[model samples]
Target: MAHIASLSQLQTPPWASVDGQLVPYDGVRIHISAEALTRALSVFEGVKGYWDPASETFSLRTPREHYERLLRSAKLFHIPVDFDYPEFLRRLEQLAAELLVRERDLWFRPTLYVTEGHWGEGTRATLVITAFTQQKESGEPMRLGVSTWRRGTDVDLPTRVKSSANYVVARLARIEARRLGYDDAILLNREGRVAEATGACVVALLDDEVVVPPSSEGALDSLTVRILERICHRDGLRLVRRPIDRTELLAAQEVAIAGTISELTLVSEIDGFTFPVDGVLARLRASYLQVMRGTEHLEGVEMVATDAGRALVTS
Candidate 1:
């Protein structure tokens, strides 16, 4: 692995939170109440920022929705925090202007935490924000292998909230799969239905429609998934929400995964079974790229690449 220069190595930018509050990039830390730490009472969100060199402007897509989800997660987890959405967005933009110099991609993570105090209880909630430069855009398709490990049952842990505790199951599954020469893992729900990949939502193209595991599949309700769904409906593609079995994946004409970080990625192969790159997945990939870049607008029925053999929209 190669090392990119850390933010500490760069000149600090003029950044602030929504409330015109400045956070120390040098020594910022979150203090969690003892009870919150012991019980894992915290919520977080992940967002991506793009730096456009041509315009010298840093832009984030749907930042407010990300914050809203964060707040929703906090409420879900019973973690109380002093939250202000509008101010938060302003602070992120200010931070991007101050800290980020190059037009590279970046990932922003903001966490609301409860710090422990005396008597095994929490004192106050704190916020920790960190930004890192991303060297690669997540446009390339990934190879996937279905994991033997089942995703954690929602009964065991809340799967709806973006909490630190939920990632333990994901970490173990993804790490073990990577050890087996897989790019990623697809976790199965309790009933052997498709769940999702590590840190991403999964959708498969089947029967000439876009099929995603229903919310009951124990998958996170992803904002990206919602956006893609809108695109699908507009394209007149049949969008089905149901339990997708392993065989469905094998039978899938094309496979794509969605997320805030990963965006729309074509799954070139699954479980060592290579699907043709020039297929329906390829078309979805092309259309998805156009929509995200704000290049093409979908007006009812539109043409999309189904495989790699078809032409792609390139930079």
Candidate 2:
């Protein structure tokens, strides 16, 4: 979408929840000198709300887990969450109620921006919930390539925290991937171990075991990966996390990228190595599709479905 300088702001919903207060989207503002703008001091979470045709409701994937992770990011960056957790959730409930009236898919991102505080004065932050209508991907097969850009280590902008700054790596990696004639890039660590795909977690099926790189390898603490692990255990598949060398990914039986936005896209060809469409990723996608269609529900994650108004369908 082309972001027109002034008019682009008008395209989103009329209202936004800023620091627990629902305000006009046009009225939402942050100074040019703000820490989020100047120092890139902001952390956020991506939550997808899928519109289910059968139930005539919106199904969200792990909004609670996303929020909890956001809070942890805030804590790590010294950005105090200025809003109450329950109230924060209620704000989402309140926002979803009003916004989902159109009954289409949407993406809600709750970003915690460090509005103030440097030195010993104590940092403060603002929670802004922005909702926009987005089309859900049908999980396509992707051509993956390894990028020369290594994902940053824990000491240098850790990958574990879902921070705004992390997008630079993803953004650059994506551009480089496309430029290199591929759909996306797999970022390797300094040690040449597989970290993750550009913006999603990496899952490889090696010798019938679903293998994932550990967080120590600079992979994000992915909720989608957690769901995949549960699915593997439920289906009698072994899932393990360890450092994956660059060559190991080429040898994986099936490889895919997992995330909220990316969904679960299988990697068809990586570095010229082709993985014929197989049941490994297909099985995972089946469960994910079930979750989307609400045949299978998330445990502890509220699937917010709007009837005439807002209502919570908890797991």
Candidate 3:
């Protein structure tokens, strides 16, 4: 996923847990020719943790889903890591407690990076858990734009996996959008259908339902979008999964970007086409925040606190 901390004044801790070792951030290093750097032999998951002052805890949103997706990405790219799911969670809890202070939201980037070798040979993956605090406002809904470049298909780059190399395409598109004075870019698939916006999913409201482009159309399986899907089903909101045309989005009543970092940023316009700030997106955003930020109790969230006496002691 694209960095959600991009819009925030993020604070990084002094230390990072590198392959189960707590190493200082400045001490962390990899060779310039490492496979991860040269060939992008890595996959990562961005886990957001909401800090609840009343409870004195950091509630992690859908960690299991994100973990499964991370494993799938590693499997797809053959990025072998030494740690299993149990060990992974242990490291995350240990790291977050060490890095994050009380009363602050946390973000973790658990990345499996190959530090040596090349072209599917002589490679070993290391788990690097990078932590940050969402210390600033994310600002207003992004002023979005559409890139002229077409996104790669599953047959080539495989959007089903959140591989590091896949983002090179997004980086290019993002540069183009920034130059044109737009905050972010939405890339179309090879067939001119809406795939996703950079690292976020493209969600549009039409009539009574919200439309999301399927993974078959080059959209990555998004964790945030999946949560929103369940919210819609539970709340009786109609959410459709299909290919979305650019014009279809333009003509829709509302548009927004959904992902781990962007959360539910409502779109102001796209390629000069304006979208209204409607109730549908607002409701979805509100429900999502209520669930994610611990205001509303929901199933499948992992809460961790610095001290056992602080709050809901899920860890």
Task: Quantify all predictions' global Cα lDDT against the true fold.
Answer: 0.67, 0.78, 0.80
lDDT of 3 by residue, 1-315 (tens): 134335224454788889988998778887888888888788998888777767666666677787899989988898776777778877777777676666567778888888876788877888888887774244367778889978898889999889888899998888899899888899999899999988799999998698899999889998888888888888899988999888888888899999887788888889898877657898898888888777776555554444422433444
Candidate topping TM-score: 3
**1-315, model 1: which lDDT tens digit per residue?**
012113424534334232245666654544443444776766778777655444444566567788888888877666665758767776666555555545465667777766644442455656666666665454666788888878767677767888877877787787877798777789898788898887788888888778887667878888777777777777677777888998888788888787766777777888877766667657766776566544566543222211111111121
lDDT of 3: 0.80
For model 2, residues 1-315, the per-residue Cα lDDT tens digits are 111011224456887889878899889998887888888889998787777756666766677788789888877877777676667667776667667644567667788887777742567788888887654446568888999889889999888889989878877887898898888899998999999987789989898898999999999999888888877777788989988899989988998888876667788999999996667887788887677657886564456554423353321
Per model, state how many residue pairs clash: 19, 0, 0
- Candidate 1's clash total is 19
TM-scores of all models?
A: 0.81, 0.89, 0.91
Which of the two candidates, 1 or 3, achieves a greater TM-score against the reference?
3
Which RMSD values do the candidates have, in order? 7.6, 4.2, 3.1
For model 1, the local distance difference test gives 0.67
Index of the highest-lDDT prediction: 3
Query: For model 3, what is the error of residue 42's alpha carbon versus the real structure, in angstroms, after optimal superposition?
Result: 0.9
